[model samples]
Target: MARQTSFIKLEGTIGDVTFYKGANGSFARQKGGVSRDKILNSPAFQRTRENLAEFARAAAAAQLLKGAFREITLRAKDLRTHNRLYAMAMSIIKSDLVSDRGMRQFNLGDMSLIEGFQFNINAGWNTTVYARYTIQNGASDITADFEDFVPAVKVSRPTGATHFRFFFSAAAINAEANTVESTYVASPEVEITSQVTSGFSFSIPKLVIPDTTQVYAMGIEYLQEVNGNLYDLNNKVHNSSKIFLVEQV
Candidate 1:
């Protein structure tokens, strides 16, 4: 590989070299490597083929998860959420002890591995909200419980933020079937300076689906109230959300 310093910034193939623009700048490399046919049919590249298959499985599973949480993650996620989830998905798929290496699947792996994952790295749930809370799954609903919660003291208020709210979302994802059932619920907005009444809680119906993985998320959103409307503070840069629990049943 060599850097292209000529006046003509070229892309595409030029004789034996292929030139292209990358993040670091334009560069050229010789177009000589293993052929696609050889990699697919050769005995020596069997491991490579297995790795590609597993990679595809992980990528697909990651896409499914992203879709499952798309509502809360629309503004609460970081730029690298896809890559981060992809890496975790690969780890989860690799943990499938019952399946063969190349044939590993999400249904056979531990979905709990993704529990406690933060969608936004900048503002984490634990760091933004100091109040102690417990999440419990009931027969019909999932509940997030908080006792003696004080917003001014327990919550980390960002600049120009006037009010905040707590949100809960759950999804029942069936990886094998490629389907999802989900719901979202939120607590009433409270002023940042006011005290949240003791024994505050938020609940959403439990989605019990056969042969599905249930994932729950809890998040805090900050808002600034104008003359008559509420707007997101800091363009959602300080919004914090996390995966509170994951259960495969």
Candidate 2:
């Protein structure tokens, strides 16, 4: 009889929403600074978090278990490939937040208030990316329609072939247009994208609402197809994923 063996156990924080920490490092929660768990437990938050968590874990597992080689060598190229795959996974996670329908309930701070969202790709095949949105309104009155907004992302493959794609639901949309009109400063239509290597970013003009009236919630459906197959041994392929939300002003 053969014994079952697990190669790696997946566990870690996916997307966490916290309030803008002041100089003292304290903010509000339900209204302003909230704990990660609070945001995670919310029905809407849980849905997207769970889905994305499953997707990320599955993606990591697939890389380890689904490959054709059994006793695989961890060569430099292999590590590099894994790093690229991980980056794709992170991108998928971020995209999910933007397109998640449930996130619409929470008021995200003003985009202008947000200094910027930073993405860091490390050398050890580990990559971390996060966006900081300044929460002006203690809370948000608007909701997001995850389904309507589409994530316009572009990926460029460098070393070898990599597979990646994503989609959103109509549910993710701007709910509180009335609020944004009064609050924040509106910037000229800005476009963000990745370098030629393998990343891209672009804000949807129509989706950009007045930072005062409506909050911005974005969802992303992501897919990465390295070979002909989409998923891994778990019958999961890195395909369609989303992110939804409502931003505050």
Q: Model 2 scores what on Cα lDDT? A: 0.29
Candidate 1 structure, TM-score to reference: 0.87
lDDT at residue 184 of model 2 (Cα atoms): 16
Q: Which digits, one per residue and each the tens of the lDDT, describe model 1 over residues 137-201?
A: 88888888887877888999988898899898889999888788888898888788765668788
Q: Which pairs of residues have clashing backbones in candidate 1?
A: none
Clashes of each: 0, 61
Worst 10 residues of 2 by lDDT: 68-77
lDDT of 2 by residue, 1-249 (tens): 112133532233234423343444434333346568876777757676765665654365325321311111111123244454444434433444454442321223222221111111221111211222222222323222112211223322222223322221111122233122222111122122342222223233223334332223222212334445443212122111112333432
Q: Pick the candidate with the highest lDDT.
A: 1
Model 1 regions more than 4 Å off: 1-13, 18-29, 194-196
**Which candidate number maximizes TM-score?**
1
Q: For each candidate, what TM-score against the reference?
A: 0.87, 0.20
lDDT values for all models: 0.87, 0.29
